[model samples]
Target: MTRPRIVIGNWKMNPLTPAAATTLATAVAREAGRVVRVGVAPPALFIPVVAEVLRETRVGIYAQDVSAEEKGAFTGQIAATMLTSYVNGTLVGHSEARRYLGDDDERVAKKLIQVLRAGLEAVLCIGEREDEFDAGATEDVLAAQLGAPLHALSESDRDGRMTERFVIAYEPVWAIGTGRPATGEHATAATKTIRRVLEEDGGIDGDAIPILYGGSVTASGAIEFAKAEGIDGALVGGASLKAEEFAGIVRAFA
Candidate 1:
């Protein structure tokens, strides 16, 4: 089967109020159903308001992050199980979480397991930093970052079909939020490395998993990135906050 095209808006810490989030979600719901799959991740606190607006639409609700720990006294952590009631899926190992929250590969692996077991799709984010790219170690960095999580996959989870729930978003840290998205050539190459590791190292069907290009994606460049070799869709950030602009991107991909 061919990989399905998808676009997910990560409204990370934006709008600053529940009323704003509800309005954004309502706007997004209006633009839904044109794309194969469209999702939005509001801040954890605003998930309910967004979910209420998107209730019957084709658009899905996602969590910006999830806890590696199942449950306990982990202050400020939202367990995967807890999110199952509110969201269809969750973003794991995002660049922000890695850089600011200190979610390394091991923790990411555990969180991936938690998400899967909780019956939620997991968007596994992996990429290299600017320094790593400057050092010509992009491929190596990508492979290493993916290693722990893939190895953490159970034998049953590697059965091809089950692996479909896992999507990869290659967001080069330097490119994110910098207005300098990776070129089509650069993204294609990076995704190639990601696919190689998924198939060769993880013993899974790489083509079955959708790999997305994230970081500073905008309407003007959406189609180019969407049509790039090996890219299935986008994991949008800043540009997603605006309804019209985000709709333009969805139309581009559609």
Candidate 2:
């Protein structure tokens, strides 16, 4: 199968204003092309501005997170269906949301279902914490996370048939923002495990899926991670706030 070169800038909660976010998004869109696919998930409030700015460009506008509800009385939750006009995709289940917001696999799975239900794509993050890794339960942890949330999908999606609207991010919680990135081998291995679980448990074609590396992905580290075997691209953090630096990461595969 052909490798998917996709780099996503997950801006998280940064950049003081929508105009500032627009500036960064425009800069990244300047580098988009046919080589590698690039997208950005600015804060929810900024998606509209960013989406409009990058409309003619290859860069896609994404939401940092979306609600599982289609439409509901759930206050403060942005439903996936509600975001169709704003973004092309979303980054669901990032470690921060799992940790600080108490979103477990079941909740993430529901969120993923909501995303796909709305005809949007998703970058699902999964990884072991530092303790789980140290305890040699990496694969075990992954299996649980990947397996649980997937139950929310119909058999087709679980079998990996939804390649276009989905991506898996192998984000080791320990690596994110710690300034300690995973080595090429480590990232590749984690993605291999991700692919294996999908292939074995879901009958998905390994090559048909794109597994990305996330965490403290710097411009320098982007080179190896982008080209590393089994690692399709990245879900960038702080560095995504910098226009030139984030564009360089996009060019790592481009």
Candidate 3:
């Protein structure tokens, strides 16, 4: 079966105003036809405005992150329950969260549990750092990053239903925001490695999962990644801030 196509924009702290947020959301919604699955994760504060604009559209709304702790005393953390009423899914274990916010694999595992329990989909980010990549251990690094979180799940959470809501994004730390994206071949190789780890180690039907390539993805570069056999779509960053560029990527995958 063909993996479903999707384009998810991670609008990390931009537009700088509610008016701009809704305007951008409306533009994206206008171009996001009913064909491919399209979603965006805006800053938490902007979610309400963006959601209001996208409510009747086919485009979906998502949260940038959710707290690993379900509730209470984790000051400044947004719980999954708090987001259940707003987003259809949440981005988990993003590299920025891992690098700056201290979300190691264990914490990522906990966040995954929370997102799943709240009945929201998760787009889990996994990749090797520049140093790890330089060591020629991309596959090993990818496996460990992905496996540790998955293995931490209970037997029941590892079942098919859990797999249904999970999406993996392979975004090399070295590639993201560097204006240099991974080649289609490199991304395809990484996707297969992720699939193998999910199936052989995690005991999940890996092929059923949609693995995306996310790294400084732009309209022109998106074509190569979209055409790659195992790459389902993208988790866009910078270029996603612009409606035309983002819609171009959606068209690439479509």
- In the order shown, the candidates' Cα RMSDs to the true structure are 1.2, 1.5, 1.0
What is candidate 3's lDDT per residue for 1-254, written digit by digit as tens? 67789899999988799999999999999899666799999999999999999999999898989999989999899999999898999999999999999999999999998998888999999999888888999999999988888888888777678777899988899997675557999999999999999988888888899998888899999999988979999999988899999999999999
Query: Residue 229's C-alpha lDDT in candidate 2?
Result: 85
Please tell me which model should have the higher TM-score, number 1 or number 2: 1
Off by over 4 Å in 2: 156-161
lDDT of 2 by residue, 28-143 (tens): 87766688888888888888888889888888888888887788699999999889988888988989999999989889989999898788888888999999988989899998
lDDT for 93 in candidate 3 is 95
- Which of 2 and 3 is ahead in TM-score? 3
Please report how far candidate 1 places residue 164 from its true position, in Å. 2.7
| Clashing residue pairs for model 3 | none
Give the per-residue lDDT digits (tens) of candidate 1, residues 25-45.
999888766656899999999
Candidate 1 accuracy as lDDT: 0.89
Each candidate's TM vs. the true structure? 0.96, 0.95, 0.97
Off by over 4 Å in 3: none
lDDT for every model?
0.89, 0.83, 0.90
